[model samples]
Target: MDTTQTAVKLILDRWEASMHNYDVLLQSLSDDQLQKEASPGKNRGVYLLGHLIAVHDSMFPLLNFGEKQYPELTKIFIESPDKAVAELPSVQELRTIWSKQRTSLKEKVDQLKAEDWFGRHTAVSEEDFAKEPHRNKLNIILTRTTHLAYHTGQMIYLK
Candidate 1:
């Protein structure tokens, strides 16, 4: 009901729509076709989707000062052709994770204070000190959401 919640809800709505569009686009391809590389150098639709899911997981851990965690999306390697291929999540699995993450983000962002939104970090300058840190708001939804939409365009256009 408040401004933060409203903004968070809008981000969640956009993300949810992206899931539907991505799912529909993938569903159109045959199994073999889905596995086919969109380009010789580029990752397949499944890989792209996995990466997107991993990005969502990244956001939570990134909010911490310094930490790393393996995302369930792409913890396994698939190189050399002899190593076993990592399995993609089932469609239902993808939907469930995406839905849960969006809901969590919506709640977290709403509860976060204005100071939390305004983040401080050191500037990349010799003169800048710990005390002279730069500030930025965690207001990147429009830009990053646009990135997802752009990647979707690539998925839709791939042969």
Candidate 2:
């Protein structure tokens, strides 16, 4: 495989690992624990997973044409949505969504040309990102991939 293809694959591989980790952690939690908040006001694992999906969904607009842009990762940080972390759909439901979304995202990453990797993307450096044109798409993928890891670690503790 060429460099670009390899780079894109690496990102997808790492993200797939992150998703596996999410599954394991969520599985360990008792159904009640699944809903337990990380803190007094924090979200639970179910909420966090939903928030994860929401976070990535936010990127769709930027990835598309930057129409429905938001300030940051979540509405997860905003008032909790009706779907509690515990109250999300069944594991099978989540599994299907997760599988589809990740595959689709990976396919998109694979399609980018070398130049397109840095194509005006503000994913990593949107606000906290340094003021430069260094917004590589791979970097953005890694950034969000790592974010999922961070939350996965937090979810482990909740159980």
Candidate 3:
């Protein structure tokens, strides 16, 4: 494999491992535990879970795989503050959504070719993206990896 191919494989492999770890951690949480905040005046585990799902759902359109399935998630988790909402999806509900979303996303990512990983992502014009080839689908995976790790740390407080 070439350097770019090797790098893409490494990123995807590591991302898959991280996501697996996150799934394990999330599944271990109790409903009571998920309600507790990591810190005072901060988001709870349930909010964090929903927010992560919302972000992942957005990746569909952002990466040109498909339209977002959960646009309402943006209103609840992205646009609104953690505690601003009177109601959010329960842990069980979020778990069901997350499971389906993750499975679909993994299938899409697995379908990508090495060249597809390097293709222009959403919003970047073909001309501009050709000039800045590093701004591609793999970059989105890298960014989301960091996001997953950050939220994983907060969820750790639930344990």
Each model's lDDT comes to 0.55, 0.63, 0.91
Q: State the lDDT at 63 in candidate 2.
A: 61
Indicate the residue-level lDDT of 62 in model 1: 45
TM-score of 2: 0.63
The better candidate by TM-score, 1 or 2, is 2
**Tens digit of per-residue lDDT, candidate 3, span 57-141:** 9889989999998889999999998889998988899999999999999999999988789887896888999899988889999
Candidates in order, TM-scores: namely: 0.54, 0.63, 0.95
Of candidates 3 and 1, the better by TM-score: 3
Residue range 52-115, candidate 2, lDDT tens digits: 7667665566565343323332543334563532344654555455566656665665566665
Report the lDDT of model 3 for residue 71: 88
**Candidate 1 C-alpha lDDT tens digits along 64-116:** 42222335454632221212454566545554665676566556545656556
lDDT comparing candidate 1 with the true structure = 0.55
Query: After aligning candidate 1 to the native by TM-score, how far in Å is the CA of 39 from where it should be?
Result: 4.2
Higher lDDT: candidate 2 or 3? 3
